[model samples]
Target: MNIKFSPVPVEDRERGRNGNCYNPGSPLTEGMKKQFMEEIKPICIEMERKYGVPAAFLGGQAVNESGFGLTRTGYFANNFCGLKFVGAWGRKPPQIMNGQDFGVETYQLIGQPDEAWDGSVRIIENLGEDRLIFDESSRYDNRYFKFKSKPEFFDFLCRITYLNGSEGRLYPKDLRYIFDEYRQNIQRGMSIRESCSLVACQLGKSGYCHTEEGNGTPPQRRCNYYSRVITEAMDEWNTYEWTKIALTQN
Candidate 1:
């Protein structure tokens, strides 16, 4: 399913211009990467276990939303994926992005865990399978449409690449390539343990960091150290399960 298109280094910026949002560059920052390990990694593990979705999807989605764990809202909301509301199993998803007077686009911030976690499993199930068909009149493209089934979705994206005067394609092949890219990035990352340790160290220095609420803040001097420990624990927990999944090939 490997597909290639002209590299649009400016595509993300274009999405921003069109009021459609996309991740910019690497999603996580150094400090926030630490925080992600300390705080958010566990949920990703659970997502793998319960949803039967690949850890990579969760990881990528988080990377997409949190801007690689940089933005403050992304840090607090624990939303790494900018999952918009889909009602009736993909019938009509309301416009979730708002535009400013100058036409700058803004996305709605989700706060609750349920806001993201509940429906994401379904989205993940369709990941790299669903295709985006553009409609010139639809808001998201005015005529942009998501196909109901994977095969149809895939073909639709392929068909439209040369249709409607567009130069790019978004078919299954493209999806596969993107997934491969994401996996490669994950594979190149530090081992879960090391990443968590880095995060935990930062948390310990902060002294006020806790994955779940109610864990009181520690002193500033030791906060970074404690954070590292917490992150390591979380990493261990996630990695253990992720390992099981890998071994079983489930």
Candidate 2:
């Protein structure tokens, strides 16, 4: 699989409001988005193998979160999926890269702390004793997890954000019904885009697909909005002939 990274054009970046480059409401052209997806195709395949999350879903997420790698975090920090750094979890702290302070915004976990795939807690229990300092505002500097490389960012994104046992475990129990229903549609030769979109909608309804904790009442409206955006983005990638071939080969 040929892999290539295409930076968003300077003019396109300038078109966005403020100093930011990409605007979600007015995203990049379809051709540009397709090129971006093509470049990340191999990473998506690797993630699917390691995490069990479908590659199509991963690609769709990249599109949804970063606007095809045009957002400030995506273009500058290489942080896709809008994954924020809660704590180091024994890893190095987020560093400054390309003038972006990776550790700037502090996040309070919505619910009980969950363990990641590696057994590290997402929200560190002890902040003061954990070698972390408060920012100027006297707040913890737990901002976005910036990556020096795309692969590293994606790996962390999948391992920490998506592989939590809450949602991950739900896959076999709560999510199985939806998956089983879609299994037939997929096996029946439904188009990948359609199948992905339908599954996304169902996942939204289940309310188990969010990256954050505190799964309560399903946010039908928000989830459906996310599904629509993700589905449309995945559908865009599906338009590429190579997507079908690549998906099959994977």
Candidate 3:
């Protein structure tokens, strides 16, 4: 879901013309943190074990992206990271998908042998077979990934983040670059806080908080707000006793 629709002026986007809210100010509450951590921490740890990504950072991202299952897509689509459907699934695309603004094209996933698909985004991989489908709107368009369970969603995120080659860097704005940085940080055995900070700062430079054609803060500032929020979320998620328990096992 790498679509950046700047149809209107960047001013309009910041002023809420498109109805996209970038900041919510409020951090996760204790009860909210506790409940959410209970739901996602285990999955985050699982993804960490499988991918070497920090559970805390990944969980923080889920909290930031999905708003703890509060957003429409979060609750309905179960799409935590805005993973869009860029191709079809199994067979040719259905005609209904083309009725919208424009025709929906099916494509073969990168690194997969079968190739071009319609319906939902699917690729043969070790993460898991299930993929999430997002057919409601085209904002983060592309069949988007769907999952049967929440853990699967988290796992998909980790796997996709770590995908090699050209297509693997689709999500998270700058995954290829980010993964490289994280890989370095992981090899160094940086603490969760340090790793997440590295992620935030690097992504900020990638226009995480940019506006206008190029009229926005520097990379440091652009990504600062979300980076701060994400890092804070990790702490909030950590305070939960259950989250502590799960992380201990990790």
The Cα error of candidate 3 at residue 127, in Å, is 45
**Candidate with more favorable, higher lDDT: 2 or 3:** 2
**Candidate 3 TM-score, C-alpha based:** 0.56
Ranking by lDDT: 2, 3, 1
RMSD of each: 19.6, 11.2, 12.6
Task: Residues 1-250, candidate 2: write the lDDT tens digits.
Answer: 3222332222232221222223332346778776877788887777655654556866887877887777666766787765545343323322321123433332221222232233333332223222221122212222445678778877765564545433222122235455456547756988767776776776666554453323454577546766787888777666323335444665
Q: Give the best candidate by TM-score.
A: 3
Residue range 102-128, candidate 3, lDDT tens digits = 333222111221112333433222222
Worst 10 residues of 1 by lDDT: 121-130
Clashing pairs in 2: none
TM-score of each: 0.30, 0.53, 0.56
Scored against the true structure, residue 53 in model 1 reaches a CA lDDT of 30
Q: Which ten residues in a row have the lowest lDDT in candidate 3?
A: 107-116
Better structure of 2 and 3 per TM-score: 3
lDDT of 2: 0.53
